[model samples]
Target: MNEQAAEIRKARFGALPERVAFEDMVEEKAVLSANHARDAYDPDGLAVRFSCLAADLGL
Candidate 1:
């Protein structure tokens, strides 16, 4: 039974790679946008948004 399962697993997945590159695993993108710089660092704006979200969730 174990041999049959092993054969099925091997057939389905083929062989595993010994190592994977970081570049192969991730697609890099910008974390911050250029246009929203004015509002991005506003603590009051963040606090208001957080409070709204928490209220919406009844938290």
Candidate 2:
């Protein structure tokens, strides 16, 4: 993944350092509640849920 990112960066920019370094970041967790329902669709619930999450995250 780091190599891929470096390649993309190099494509945007012209050059890269002789020794490129990459650091791994802490993986993010899901902010939404996990749903176990099958064949269930709720657009309004999702909208409200995401709205609350966005507010909580100050987005």
Candidate 3:
């Protein structure tokens, strides 16, 4: 992330959780999708992901 974005993130999240880093969050979601695809998938999981993403983007 750029310096300004990192600063914004720190301010919003109060020193962001390690797992909540932007890149890490994307990776986490990809892993979630892959794992779910390999087994049983919960439709709610994708909905929850979209809700979180929308909220984060202030939509």
For each candidate, give its TM-score against the true structure: 0.32, 0.25, 0.24
> Which scores higher on TM-score, 2 or 3?
2
**Candidate 2 TM-score versus the reference:** 0.25
For 1-59, candidate 3 gives per-residue lDDT tens digits of 69999889878889543555677556433433456564766777767656676766888
The candidate maximizing lDDT is: 1
Candidate 3 has what TM-score?
0.24
Best prediction by TM-score: 1
**CA lDDT for candidate 3:** 0.67
Candidate 3 segments exceeding 4 Å error: 16-59
The whole-model lDDT of each prediction reads 0.82, 0.72, 0.67
Better of 1 and 3 by lDDT: 1
RMSD to the native, candidate 2? 19.7
> Mind giving the per-residue lDDT tens digits that candidate 2 earns over 1-59?
99999889988996755764453435567898666684478876777657676766889
RMSD of 3: 22.9
Residue pairs in clash, model 3: none
Q: CA shift at 38, candidate 2, in angstroms?
A: 94
